[model samples]
Target: MLIRDLPEDVVMEILSRLPVESLMRFKCVNKAWYFLIRNPDFIAKHLFWATSEKRHRGLLLNREHEITRTPWVSLHSNETLEVSRYVDLLQFFPRDVGELVVFGPCNGILCLFGVPADRNGPRDGLVLWNPATRESKALPIIQRPAEMPTTFPFRFGFGLDPKTGDLKVIRILNLNFRRCQVEVYNLSTDSWRVINTSVNPIYRINSPRFPSYLNGVHYWLACERGGPDHWLMLSFDMSNEVFQEIALPSLTERPSFEAVAVINDSVALILAYNDLATRFYYICVMNESGEEKTWTLMFTIGPLLHFTRLIELRDDGFVLLRNKNGWLVLYDPITQEQRELPIYGDSFQVVSYTETLVMLNGSGECA
Candidate 1:
């Protein structure tokens, strides 16, 4: 009747249901447990349970010098938001790496990028980190094209291929005003390859905003190269390694601001319209992924005094918003209530993440 005497399947079922923090500690109990926990099949099953049961539904706040994790709870209710834990970047990375910019939490792996303080030093700014496991892998150095401009803009996105179970990191570098260079890094191969693709001249990926990964695709809000006159949704399929453009709903007046986030397993677009006379924000959700006509306005809030950005639309029906001051605020679309979260930090970035033991190499085995 002892636990170790149980069948392997039964042990796996029990272990998979445990939290990641507990599972990490349990791995040290015995060599058998260690191997079992590190098995690729076991890791997948554990992640399946973790996501399906909503075991680790929380907010990953990227601060100036640290990354803080907190539970996303109802603001109107008695539930309180507290920092469950955090990781200091300086402890794991050198300060001379410049400012750390986080890319994604695709399957619990965060893609980080930073510029080296010394231009002559190493340029391998890409780092893949798993907060739960505290394990990280540095990607190979990226070669700067000789034709690159002095101040070119670049953005990074992370995604997982469901069909092949591969983790891919995509970097879109704007070579010039009209040209873009695309590069994709495959975790399974541990190599970076340039994608020979041409982007439309009228549309450009907005580098200031992060891309949303859902259903094996990464989505970004693309606008007219220099102005906000036109907007479109750009999607990249990780499995096929292809890009597709989806037209957005036409607006009476071009939106002054726009952002995209994943809401309720669908793509949601937050549009803000401002003029000298009035200003308003609209929350539009597309029930279907690629269907442009499905874009319906869910709710409209405000003619506020300040400009606000949409951080996320939580599962509990609350929207995480950030104001001009960079403070975290929770807005309930149903109740139409707004309140500030107690997390005090400058330059806030939030991402909806589920805790998992997914390794950076796309294999459960330790690298």
Candidate 2:
């Protein structure tokens, strides 16, 4: 029998096993195949199989320099952490936009915030990009409040609302260390709505660090002032559009650097103390979500000499690290082994990446 004559279920099964690049080209063969590949149900099935099979493992490295570039480094082995290839991202963006800040990669779509090279150029500053399919959509410009201070730093969080299957972007305008304005943009509506919820007065977030998204929620490391340094985990639920705080484990001394990340489907905290004096590092994993008592010390590595930043935690007992010299190194906490990856770049921002066929047109609809 011919390929086209195959049953719908069989066709979908075969298509799901193929890479996204192949499927994108296959869609052009015929309208029947185009609609079939673009179907929401098929996309979900492909994603499920891709994740469970671990087929799309890679590293997205953002190289910051005169001409910013994003290169996707494919990971082949967890033990060796070998780089398979470096995929250039220049084709995914426009010519005029140079500097782009990537937000989240929830469900394969990366939300990007960029400014035009020319200050007064006409362009959509915000964009949604799907690297697997090479599809991108520039979102409309957001209007700020009249009274909002010009110098107020803006923080953004991107995630998908599992309840409604809507892609939402949460923007927080920090007017000061204590108070701020919050807004949410719904992809389906193509508009931004000002959320009346105010951030907790006791906690203040570090805007320079990006928020981590896991299971339809965004997490940020926040600190409380006045007495001793108190760090807390701040979370925003995209499904319900609400905010909550989770307390961190007690610390004798404030960590010089701290960030929140997801490890093995649970929230994990990476803390580094006094880089100048101490070579000790700490990794704390939460046994249960939203529970302060469940936080447990996972690992403590000592004499790590310049390994200062934790880029990501791998499933096979290894953690990706960035030393003070700014090189990417793979360190095994269990075996006490360390090796530097052969990725050459001036500056690198690494993020966990998985390739998918998720559409960026609107919500989950195909363009």
RMSD value for candidate 1: 4.4
Maximum-TM-score candidate: 1
Cα RMSD of all models vs. native, in order, equals 4.4, 3.8
lDDT tens readout by residue for model 1, 1-367: 9889999999999999887779889999999999899888998998999888777654566655334332121112112456666555554445465455667667777777776655666664788877677678878877787887534556777889999988889988776656777899988788999887756755777753443888898888888766666678788889887888777887787675567777667677878887665557787887665453467998776655455666655677776777666677888766768898765454556665677888765445443
Name the best candidate (by lDDT): 1
Query: Given candidate 2, what's the lDDT at residue 123?
Result: 45
Cα lDDT tens digits for candidate 2, 251-277 = 777675468877666677877765666
Global lDDT for candidate 2?
0.70
**lDDT of residue 2 for candidate 1:** 89
RMSD of 2: 3.8
What would the TM-score be for candidate 2 when compared with the true structure?
0.83
Model 1 lDDT vs. the true structure?
0.71
